[model samples]
Target: MTQTVGKRPAEDMTQVKLNVKWGKETYNDVEVDVSQPPLVFKSQLFALTGVPPDRQKVMIKGALLKDDEWGKSAPKEGMTIMLMGSAEAVPVEAPKNIPKFVEDLPEAEQEHLETKRFGAGLHNLGNTCYMNSTLQCMFAVQPLREALYKKASGAGGDPTGRLVTAIAELFKDLESGGAPFPPYAFLVALRAKFPQFAQQTQGVFAQQDAEECWTNVMYAMREKVKDEDGNPVVDKLFGMRTRLRLKSDESAEEFTEDGMTYTLKVNIEEKTAHVSEGVALGLKEERERSSVAMGRTVVFRGGTSLTALPPFLTLQMMRFFFRRDNGQKAKILKKIPFSLEFDAFEFCSDELKKELEAPRVAYKEAQDREIEAKKLAKKGPGPSAVATASAASGTLTAANAVADVDMKEAAVASTSAPTTSSSTKLSMTGKYELVGVVTHKGRTADSGHYVAWVKQSSDGTWVCFDDDKITVRTEEEVLQLSGGGDWHMAYLLLYRAIMVDMSGAVPAAVSEAAQPAAAMETEGGSSA
Candidate 1:
């Protein structure tokens, strides 16, 4: 004998209702879901009362609701909840699929954009989100995109070539104006590279590691890339090479060690709370028993020297571990706070600190220029002469550059560094801007829903790609994905170096240093 209850559609299964109350006012029914987490719920409340998520305090009876666990707090049928917080800003919807303006964009991005940021989503077939999210996040890297989609290019008959072709085909699909498609070709290319991914688990597609997929993608991209020296361009493109030192406990720097890493593993213990802290702690020294060295028990300390920084750097949160009780891999529910700007100055070796100096100077100068321009804009369009004089004299006005900028009739237009051969080589190492985040919402490594949150490089807008449903989100909501509870914990974070354009003008000293031969072209142009 068998019993069956009627199954609802996938849409209804994902959403639930809550009776919300704020003082004398009450919203008898409101629809929300765990799929997007409580941050979206707060956004919903913000819609109702014009209060921001960060300012609102939501409570059930006397108990307060945290962002990740709001699903558990809701009753099966539905329950009433209380809200407390002042309304700071008027209620407003975020940017939609079609944008309105470039008002809030950075000075460098104040121009017209052809493509909307993260306008398309990928189709998730079964438990294929693990692969989909990783692919979506990898698509955020500009160099990777350029390499894969450069016109009249074909991937040669190599293991990486197939993967490259698959990526290129998928990019075309994502960029095209239409519905999302299943990445069957990408899956085939992936499985061809690693047969284990093709294996069936319980007659279903087995979920694989996102980091492993990312590494394979990186390797494939590197194989297709070549340098002038005819060597692999892996390190120069996206590798984070490190220098390690192996020494006796009593002696310092007795032995040398060097290696390269594409990803940094954030080891978690019950004690650590933040991602940066975990990374700093993970770089600590270790003692091991060795057979070769006279100091049988050697103290090996790994000091990471940033020999080269790729356009994109990826960090993985070591969330899954082998649980002895379950006899299987289990997920970590630790909430590790990440930042929009990540500082890695403490982690860099002495030499790297010096290498990052020039770019830092260029960035500072560019920022100062923006600040001065904004100051002039605030004074209103009276004397464009004074602003032009200031620009020529290289002087910074006594005004701070805030987001509330009015660029109407400004003298100098802000821009980023030129696309020179060495542009990627130099950047502010300490400052890393968050570009893409891949999150998983499940208890085990074997199965779960994976989603990607990608930032639009043109404007500071975030779009969450959950399978085929693409929704724009706020920075407040994206920050909640940093992970504390079981909902959607950020598993991987991708960071890119922060570099500003010098407003279309390169420094005379650096320009001369960058290319001595290019100077001959300038003289020839003058003669002509």
Candidate 2:
């Protein structure tokens, strides 16, 4: 079936003629649709030149055509368009190979073949369970997994690029149905880049913290992995732009700064019982420093606010602390419960909240309509149902209308072309749902077993990845990971944004929300 892209219907399409010029070749009278989005035009160019939409730079009359806009200067009949992009050589499709007949094989061979057809686990190389667990959690990110596959297919020969390619290979092995295999090459590449992972004591590799390894691996990916347009893929998914505001009662000034972070570190305190409390504490802090405004030391209250939220959010629970007596990091077995659905609206700045309000309202209305439709569906078709069929028909029609809008928005979001603005491409609603988690089981941070719990996309059930052992777990059992005892407690939580049905047209609110954070410092020993 032919898919209709963009907001306009097929009947509204207005085709025009344009002359396309690439490197050394010029094609005359190419058909162009003026009614559709610019991305559609780029896709047509890709088919002709073998150049991906993200890599193509299409210019008409010296004005660049953006993925999100059609531009004020419209294309006319027989207009010349300049396209500059390198055409990538396409790989030929390979024929599938047939495996040996399972029925004629021995019982053990058949069993092995059966297990290989299922999702394969990772073999623990010594105390490498931490790495295995982290890998599993990372693989749970569908977008990241997809990106890794693309990188593996057409990656550079650099060390970081090799590392990504190796990871993709490992992931492919795991998914190809079979027994657990050692991620030897991936580990070698990782240790080569970050020597800290190769630490040893008495000729034996020592156990390391999973969070540290996770941080380092993510840092490497952020530095190396890029989309077709050469933008960091890691940052586009997991990075957040934050603003730190520091205020003091003794001074009439606030010092503010903006920075990027991949994860939010939540410090577990004595009074912390839930993850939300820890997150709240993580956003605010008190520090005593020399106040330049007062010419004396004074206490300052500092708070961090989200300037922009990414599609994926990572929260690291500070479960370990350095013990002064033992000189080792000890774990905090405090019981902290985290909700499946997290609302980050409260943590956002006032301006961001205002910007998110409309989208949130739209999402809530859509959900309510769905719920009403479900209720009507459950009522069944009887005499009573027939009595209110006309009334219920209206609700169903409205729900279908909302679904149509949502489908169009999803198409826009799934486009591979780069948008004019990154903020507009992000989640409209500051809400997320827990998808993947890394948990620890031991008392000390230095030596503990790590496990990954990931929600399967096919079925909403949770699966536990324990090194070479894999088990299906219920949602309730997964929630029990909230620490109260020595059992596995969540260490790293990955949340995916709950997508809101909003299109790129809503930019006024987004730009208004993106205004730079206010900052005021002592100017010439006095407030301005």
Candidate 3:
């Protein structure tokens, strides 16, 4: 008891709205104006679905039915439309009344039938029909056809056929259920037609091939070493039987081994080898020493010729021999061994050893000269001292002496004085003289303020002094003073006299001069 609403054949359906759920998370509401007769709706459907309009599915849909005017009045409330098309029902041609049997068919014909059945099943199930189409096309071609021919003739097919069949059957089942094809299978079919996809797959395979190549090379090299019985030698015995000795022109005493007496040398340039009697005995003794070192038994089969050895092996042997000969010296030197084409082994000779120690000898000599200079400086004044003949004739002025004493007291009160906690008590004194007037007070009585001056002495020492500290005498007093013209020089003279007198009062034993003359010279130089 169902009623169907059919389309109105002659009425024009101008506007139709289609609600489409396009893939996951996407929906579209499309309005189509189909004012013209014979309107094609597949392109419009794809436009509504957001699928490419020119894609195969849209083309196939269009081919199925170019126009279906009967769909005009179809109930449009979420009703699905089925495009009108003829089913793939080919006319069954009579085979001239011949009887049919599955086993009687030719092998090729039987295979074709089997493939068609599988392809049809895949199409019904909405499986990867595009991929199935490709396979059918491949089977129709040479190699694949031959392969199928062999398989049908009982020549046996590879496991790949079974995989392909199973994939086709799964797609067929999904199509039958009206479900969309799986994205992965759809992609596989799409990529087969796209060259970039093949390149990506090939790239992955290429990386695996490279890794396999390296692994094979390592295994082949490791297998090359074998024992006399043709079995691979144990890891412990591999490379254990080889020994190399270096023979140099130097004397046997110049090189020695810890537990062996052998001394052998090789002249690399001349390709000559030499062995000393001690070296011969040492080679025999090395067997026992090596056995002890390895904590196992070792037999010395007499040394063999290494003339055709590789350069790498030769260089390794040279380093081994060098270390055995002078391990301690080599460690101290931390030398890097190189080819004779570069520098010679100059660091290993006796001459080089002496040259290395020469610096220490020179250092000791310089230290002795320093000690001698210190001894000389410690001796105060030598015996031949000249006497001042008129020393008592010159009278010391009390005023000048008092001024000098006051200046000395002022200097002692300053923080610049040296401490006497140590044995050496250093005292520094200098004579300062005013050379230029940078600022001067005016001659007015109220302008008798302090003025600054630059001063220099015969030895070129200059100092600035405040003239306010000096006593200003009247013109009559200045006339009485014979040396008043250079008032700054007089002040400096008084200062030096005060320092000299004070020096006399301090104990001579505690003086810096009590130390060596070298110490006094150093103290004087530092004070300046």
Model 2, global lDDT: 0.68
TM per prediction: 0.64, 0.68, 0.13
Candidate 1 residue-pair clash tally: 3
Worst 10-residue lDDT window for candidate 1 reads 519-528
The model with the greater TM-score, 2 or 3, is 2
lDDT (tens digit, per residue) of candidate 3 on 244-296: 33222222212232111011222122221221221233333222223434455
Task: Evaluate all candidate structures by whole-model CA lDDT and list the values in order.
Answer: 0.60, 0.68, 0.25
Local accuracy of candidate 1 as per-residue lDDT tens digits, 328-392: 88998888888876766567767656755665676566566556667776777657846654673
- Cα deviation at 480, candidate 1, in Å, is 1.0
The Cα RMSD of model 2 versus the native structure comes to: 20.4
- Across 218-331, the per-residue lDDT of candidate 2 in tens digits comes to 877776666665666677667767788888888856778877788887878998978888888998977777888889889889899886666678999999999999899998
Q: Which ten residues in a row have the lowest lDDT in candidate 2?
A: 518-527
Clashing pairs in 2: 116-177, 116-178
